[model samples]
Target: MSVLETFQLAIKNILSSKMRTFLTMLGIIIGVCAVIVIVGLGNGMQGYIEDSFADMGTDSLTVMIMGRGSSRSVSEEDMYELVEENSEYLKQISPTVTMMGSVKIGSDTLTATSITGISEDYFSMKGYEVVQGRGLQYMDMTDRKKVCVVGQYLNMAYFGGNAVGQTLKINGNTFTIVGVMAQEGSELEEGGTDDCVFVPYSTAARLSYTGTISSYAITVQNTDQISEAKAVVEQKLYQVFSDDDAYTVTSMAELVEEMNSMVNMIIYILAGIAAISLVVGGIGIMNIMLVSVTERTREIGIRKALGAKESAIMRQFVIEAATTSSLGGVLGILLGYGLSALATSVIANVMPDTPITVSPSLLAVVVAFGVSTGIGVVFGYLPAKKAANLNPIDALRYD
Candidate 1:
């Protein structure tokens, strides 16, 4: 018989035993779906994290000091000296001092409010735009102005509306609200441009008895110069701290790279788990194919009696197994895509900055796994061979 005729017969047999064929295909379908969904989730999470970092500005670097054995703190003078030394390479350097305090507007008081002392560079470095009024200016820092910028939540919590040009007291010290920041998404709620109140660093220094800046934020001239700028800042910081290990200098790109590495490791681990499903599916195909060979023993003997070649019989059985796997693979791909889309939409709603991405390579791997499972006829070989070798006369005579 022609190859096409053999394929037709194989398909007909599978259609005749639709329930068994479907059960056999179930394994491949599940395996493919697992791989696609898991890998796509990994890709989406990575994309989401990276985008959040990008939204915070990639050209920024943070510097914090670690002191000697007895004390662990950064001096205000050390931060000022570092900034003065790196003025050429740095675009803007700001000293930041943060604390959680209560804000009071008239009789209303909101607790657990974020208050930070920052320089003029804080706005641009953190990608914050002034929605009302204006940001802190150089004069504000130098003059130690008792004015501050408030986040959107604080505005609503304290003043019940736009807090710009209003007066809010922090820890018993009243400050005029000169600016209000635009609403940044939830990603910023953790640690970004939003969800904080900003006062001049010098003013915060006067208010706090610590007399030290917590950290410094430095913006580079360009992203390409971030590495050089980090090195330069570190060198400058070392002159003051001298111990070299006392301070930590980190750039946004380096942080993102580390985060990506962590994400990739997670993806690999999940992918490994998903791969096991494919093996299980392949075994199911093998088991079903073996049963098919046993049930078709008499039919196989008749075919051989009609001069059907062993290779033809083997090819027909293999095609049947492959078709089952291939059909499952296609269904799995469709299901995987739908699952990815649904997950991405839910994640996007929660984290506007994080975009979920479906990886094409993951899809390819799923399809390949399905095809490999179909080719598991190698495992079904012993049964096919036994059936082909059966004597036609005996098969015909047997009940």
Candidate 2:
């Protein structure tokens, strides 16, 4: 028979044994489905991580001063001058001091509200907007003013959304509210992003009773040159303390890249584990094809007696097996998509804060289909060879 005729006959034969063909394709279906779903989940997790990092602002760096085995210390002015000297890369610098105490408003003590001291540029550097009143100015820092800004959560909860010009006490020290920040989260809840307070860095240092500022937040002029800015800061700190352990400079962009790499590594490992099912499915195809050859031995003998070549017989079996596997792959792809959509819906409903969408890429679908078809060819070889080598003798009466 010609190649097209052989392929048609193979399809007819496969269709004649519906249950058996389906059973043979079941393994491939499961294997492909598993691989696609796992890859989609990995992609969703990676996307969520990137978004979380974006909220934290990847164009900035944080420096922590910890003088271990050294008596040297870097001053806040030194950090500012470092940014000024390296104006080619660095842009703004803010000394951050987190106060440890609950906020007091009259007789009520708001424990969920955090208090932090920051410079005037910190607001612009972090891209935070003040909707009511005005933000911190250079005068506030220089004069050690007891002025503060409240987040939307605290404002709405305590001051009925009219928190600007109101006063809240932190660490028993009264601070007048100069501005109210725009809402940071969708919902105003306790201990959420919009449940904090900000004061002048100099005022915070005095209230917290700390003469030395050990933490600093620095923003880069160009995000693409974050590494260069980080190196310059690190080099300046090293020159001051002469010890790498004295101070640590960390870039938010670098942290995001490291986290992404770790997530990808974990996903690759899980995908590898899920891929073992494909090998098992290939073995199943081989076993079923071998049984098929045995069951069709008589038919093969009749065809050979009618002058069919061994190559034609082999090609016919291989093509039928390939078609079976390809059909399974198609079904698996459809199922994977359905499951991915369902997972996305369920995640969005359950964890509204972190809505991770399961999205399978076209590349993954194509690879899965290609691998399934390739397995069919590789595993079907032995059975096809057996069928092609069947004896055509014995007069056909032994049946």
Top TM-score hit:
2
Candidate 1 residue-wise lDDT, 1-399, digit = tens? 777887788789879988887787776677677778777777767777778788767888888776654454556666666667777667877888875567677987756567889988788887788888899999998898999998877766556667888888888998999998888765434234355788998898888865566588888887887898899978866765678888889898889888989988987787677767766777887887777777777787788889888887877877676667777777777777788788777777986655677654654664556455545565556556666667777766545
User: Candidate 1: which stretches are off by over 4 Å?
Assistant: 1-3, 69-90, 160-162, 186-195, 221-229, 239-244, 341-399
Q: List the residue pairs that clash in candidate 1.
A: none
Backbone clash pairs in model 2 (N, Cα, C under 3 Å; residues 3+ apart or in different chains), count: 0
Per-model TM-score, in order, reads 0.82, 0.96
Count of clashing pairs, candidate 1: 0
lDDT: worst 10-residue window of model 1? 186-195
The TM-score between candidate 2 and the true structure equals: 0.96
Work out candidate 1's RMSD over C-alphas: 4.0
User: CA lDDT of 378 in candidate 1?
Assistant: 57
